[model samples]
Target: MQQKGGAAPSLFRNGFLQTILLSNVLLQIGIWVRNFAILLYVSETTAKDPYAISLISVAEFAPIFVFSFIGGTFADRWRPKRTMVWCDLLSAVSVFAVLLTIHFGSWHFVYLVTFISAILSQFSQPSGMRLFKRHVPEEQLQQGMALFQSMMAIFMVLGPMLGTFVYSTFGLETSIAVMGVVFLLSALVLVRLPKDEQEPRTEEGKGQFRREFVEGFRYVWHSPVLRMLGAAFILAGLAVGVAQALGLFVVTERLGKTEEFLQYMLMVNGAAMLIGGGIVAVFAKRVAPQILLAIGMVVGAVCTILVGYSTSVPVTLVVQFVNGLVFPCIHIGISTMILQWSHASIVGRVNGVLNPMFVGMMVVSMSLAGPLKDAFSLVSIYVGSGLLFLFGALMMIPIMGHKAPEKAQAAAPAPAAVRTEP
Candidate 1:
């Protein structure tokens, strides 16, 4: 796993090169804006709780649990570029439809739009990732992954500010319209992806999509390594959601800040994500995925413990930054390992299983976060999450280990082990 440590390798050139970068940027912009619009519209227009926001966290991501297997199969069978293009086009059209509904003063459309976006997003993401694997070379996979993570980091870091500005300067509808345009732009960029060998077109490809979805899940059920990886991700997502759901509460109560401090807390943590992105790009492959996963869980655990005790914004920021750097390494490693273990044809199915496995856990985690916070304490949440991460790290010890004759374990190096999904 060791390689040159200081810089990422060269991996892209030409118009096709610009295409990947630009498309990633556009996709992030569209995602951020669309999510922002939903949150804002909920806070302002909805009167169910007077200041009611639909408690749709569960509904939002839980669909991936249901749809990932189908989407994954499709991603594997179809021409990836065309698949991604259609997904983006669907996104653009869907966003535009929401905008029209809003313009016509129909708040009722929000629920339908939200569900549509959720389902369509699963199709777009796995197909888009398939393009990354097809175009990027094996030797440069680490750098490619790092750069991809960084691209997401930039969008994540900048998205909220830009979305807010658009909404404020123009209007909410203007922001929604901008998201549609970005989706269209992303689709165009995807159109340039170099064609690769098509997947096997068998009767299996035409089988019941639902059955295909179950088949992917069955793959995970059968593989011990994949099962452990899934458990690690499930708990990891839940751990983060617990903390994320309570971030504002942490600062205001512990640091004695008012509600206004929420913005600063969010901004600073977002900035830390940029730091995490850089670390992942520089070290994703240089460090063994297993080793990184171990360190990530350990560091993240320590940060969480520190965060639980921190009494001020500065202390919280430092702990938060530490958590940020490690979390991405863990995430990128899991994703890279999955891609490495998969044949290109089955990559989509693998990703589809992961989409729900990861996202769906967050839904369960968020649902319980409120009850947990009320019953125990925020510090308990942090400590519990940290403990779960430690458990997750320990779980990885067997996964990355090679399955060979017992005699080989003595002769071969004891590879660094961590919880892995691939």
Candidate 2:
């Protein structure tokens, strides 16, 4: 593991990093605006029906389950710059199509737009990961991941607020147009990325999508660290999924709070994540990633349990904040581990395989959360989830005792391999 001094490291010295961050910030803003606008549009247009609102979530998430692995496969083969740019361009076009559909007097196209954007995002995300792996130095990978996540944390807090403001003040059409324009701008900015420096593909690599896809799975299965990581993520997802599924009920029925209070709690958590991401970015290199991850999981598990048992609103909010703060530790640890352990050749596919384990499991856990709450109680669900988190934390202990696999060490590229043009 690489350690830096206490002062903040200068990751921004690289022009490529600056360009990607600027474009990503703009793209995130547009996405958040579009997301909130569509959400509000669905709520208002459907008379606040729960089913209609749920459809938006389904539309947004289903593609991840269906296409993430495929996206990862293609991400490995394709130039990251071109793939990301085209995905953003296509997303912009999709948003414009949604605008056109609305103008033609049909509201149903909103879900289609959401679904299409999500599908494009599946492609863009893996390619972005590949780019990050290629450009960031090994020593600063954790910090890079933390900084990226911090950006996401900032957006999570502000995006919805901005989206709501834009929708309410300017109206849906204008909001959608703004979203399209931002995406287009993001694409244009991406054109500034230095050309990809990937190894040339062999003739055998030209047309073997199925074989390549299967190989990704095989690689993950062969890697002990990745195998365990997948398992941990699945359990973490279950824990989180149950909490999310029942959070509103816990607020209303248990804490005697309104929806507004729930919103505040979420906002507070988002703000905490922003703080936590900065902390990790500065200090992550000092600690072993596995140890940090274990600590994060254990703390997060305890917080989850406390949130279940705590009756006071203030107490729960504090717990939620702590939860937010610690959760990023696990995320940063895992992301850095991926960068460290996996060869660049397969990192995209590794991400593709690993992402679904967490997301798909979350979906499954969510499906079970309702019935579990109805049959048992909300507290019971929380306890179960906390226990699941504990299990994941415990699983990390064995890995903590060992050094990274020899193959992993051997596979790591030199810093120059990832350094980009000034």
The lDDT leader among the candidates is: 2
lDDT of 1 by residue, 1-422 (tens): 11334543356553444687888788787767766766776666664353246444534665687767777777766677787788888978987888788789776566555566677777767876666655655545666666676676666668888777777687677777888899899888888777655444445346456655566666666556567778888877777778777777787888888887777666666667677877777766567666666778878878877787788778888777667766677767777656655555556777888657666767677668889988998888889988877887877788657331222122222111110122
lDDT of 2: 0.83
lDDT of candidate 2 over 338-368, digit per residue (tens): 7777777677788999998988889889889
| TM of each candidate vs. truth | 0.87, 0.93
Cα lDDT listed for each candidate? 0.69, 0.83
Sum up the clashes in candidate 1.
Answer: 3
Pairs with backbone N, CA or C atoms under 3 Å apart (clashes), candidate 2: none
- lDDT at position 272, candidate 2: 93
Task: Compute the lDDT of residue 359 as modeled in candidate 1.
Answer: 68
lDDT of 2 at 29: 86
Cα deviation in Å at residue 158, candidate 1?
1.4
